[model samples]
Target: MDGYVMRLNQFISHNAKYSRREADILIEQGRVNIEKTKANTKSVLLEGQRVFIDGKYVKPKDEELYTVIVYHKPKGELVSKKDDRGRRVVYDTLGGKYMHFVPIGRLDFASEGVLLLTDNKKVAQSLMESDLEREYIIKINGKITEEMIRAMNEGIHIENASTGAHQKSKIYSMTFAPFIRYEIGKNDIHFSKLKVTIMEGKNRELRRFFAHFKADVMDLRRIRYGWINLNALPVGKIRFLNKDEYKQLHQFMGKIGKIDSFISKNNI
Candidate 1:
């Protein structure tokens, strides 16, 4: 109790009641208290301190061992807990006590492949914040020209429809190497397969990036995230990361600050 202290919002987040942002709002609204005193966003709680939100006691949960799982998400299922349209979701395919686990990022309903899930928010945050690369194999419906490949690598600007104004958003701003792995040639039809790698995970970035080139994505599947590869995992199956895998992930995160080559190898 005397040796440990944590920020009020972090304490609330660790309790799994609300996110840090939500905790801040509750604190600002005068709904949170520590030791019978009103708590602020920056207030620090000593170990064993009692916390109450809206007049209800909230005990800090004992630290649980972090659990990380690699899920082969199937297409047509969402990466959400529930869908309003009653469509099947990724969570529906999962069994046991995985209700608390959160997907690190997400694969869209139409796209599928390797997805990382974890019960520990810190682990999720760390891996996401790191400059780890993700690889995808995409089938595109168009003749991919060398000029288009050059433009994609240099970066392209697309209209930001969500911004209301005629603002433009930049994509592929980082170093991206795309290789044409397969191609189906016909007199009047063209279909090409590409293996693209990127470090950022913007929303539907790959699809949008191809759309800028007037190329339609027929299918998209993520094959790798960091050192973890989908490999031979069957669709809709989840595998818990082993101790060595977990250790390597953390080690990879540490080395991202020094060298990128460290991550290219040791992806378990």
Candidate 2:
């Protein structure tokens, strides 16, 4: 094959408005077609083959001229398209143009700050999985003790690191790398403030790390992702990546072909 070849479900998940699981369901229901022929869940798709779902033509993903945006996610907003419990989702505020964009990772419901979104799935996946620096400001209950500093310097590896994890999270064991950098802003007995930088975006990493120290994070806000900074962006607002930012992004993405090897060597 000289061009794109992928499973029918994967292609729908990437280019259509459905999750992989949802795509599988649609295929089982015989709602998807390729060149007017009914398709199965395990069907292989090739370049130039037309794909449709429920009689709606699926647009191919754009390889050129895509849009990226920075959203100042506010607290209490879920980083999802729809929440089953009627909780507010980012799309409720970012409706219309950005409705279909893929969010680059997530900021949990109670935590908020710089959230990135893009119309291109490849760009979103690259940025989400890349070993890029993420900076956050956190306020945790209790003092920033020597043990906390030592753990930040040495990192943590635990088999049951689920204290700060969501109840539904099945990921029990996790590997946290040494923080790239950390600085304490306050050291009060009741509460402390600190800024931390790390390359790993594992699930609720900060919450879990501080939880191991018996400190609960009260406030967490992300301020930066790699070269992209929140700067003066107000809460619940969205802005396009400036030309220079886009240039820097593409430059970073250009080197991601061997990203697994890169992450392995870098301890992200």
Candidate 3:
């Protein structure tokens, strides 16, 4: 009974995986609610009360400020927060205060690209949703045929059935068209490059898809996640995002930001 009410933006900043400014926007957009009442920027409440945003309940996180960082995950480094084998972790290579951030999504030991690290659980969960398109560039051995490309475009049926041949198959839809479809270009006679976009980030899905045709993947890299792109970023360097970029991402997801100047003021 002694807790004091806090501003909607502050509440969201504490509970959700967004910045204070982003939380303010969400408040203004009426995505937040308290006990079924729509929330405004000035709305406030004490602790231990029910609050919801984007149809999901919100609560204070153990950690403050949901931070997102993009790391140029190098091959051979484990993507896990901690590995029992005592091998080097991607976070270790960061060697900064941001090293404690959790990766938004997974990148296998051999694959590398713009991997996202964030303390914001909600943002991480949102990015992992299958609705968000993630793009990757894959280099592989063996010439890909037109028929194979057609199959990829149409979506390949991955069967995990352990029974009779007449059993129904599970159809996974293709989210985006291949950049360099089936045609074997003039680059290499036997090897080819392809850019594929996937909404579902299934484990080793890309490798398995190519393995069906006996193609060996030489390299794999994630180039984009949602509207965020990795442009000319060095292999082992990461760039902190600016305010506008963060704002656009929240807006795209129907979320809003309140403190518009948080990024500009902080010069992040």
User: Per-residue lDDT for 1-268 in model 3, tens only?
Assistant: 3676677776665455555777777888888888878777877786666788888888666543455777788888878645777987786778656543557778877888988877665567666763677788888887776656776767666453122111232534323234333333323557888777777655566776776666777888888877778888887888876687677656644442333356567887
Can you write out model 2's per-residue Cα lDDT over 1-268, one digit (the tens) per residue? Answer: 5666888887887776676777889999988899978899779888899998889899887676678899999999999767889999998899766666889999999999999998787788888888899999999999999988988999878788899998899988988899999999999999999999999666999999899889999999999998999999999999999989989987876777467678889999
lDDT for each residue of candidate 1 in 190-215, tens digit (9 for 90 to 100): 78877777776556777766666677
lDDT of each: 0.73, 0.88, 0.68
Worst 10 residues of 3 by lDDT: 160-169
Off by over 4 Å in 3: 1-65, 160-189, 253-268
Q: Distance from true position, residue 240, model 1, in Å?
A: 1.6
RMSD, each candidate, Å? 7.1, 3.8, 12.3
For this target, which candidate reaches the highest TM-score against the unseen true structure? 2
How many residue pairs clash in each candidate at the backbone level? 1, 0, 9
lDDT order of candidates, best first?
2, 1, 3
| Stronger candidate by lDDT (1 vs 3) | 1
Q: Give the worst 10-residue stretch by lDDT in candidate 2.
A: 252-261
TM-score of each: 0.67, 0.87, 0.62
Off by over 4 Å in 2: 1-4, 18-31, 53-56, 257-268
Q: How accurate is candidate 1 locally (lDDT)?
A: 0.73
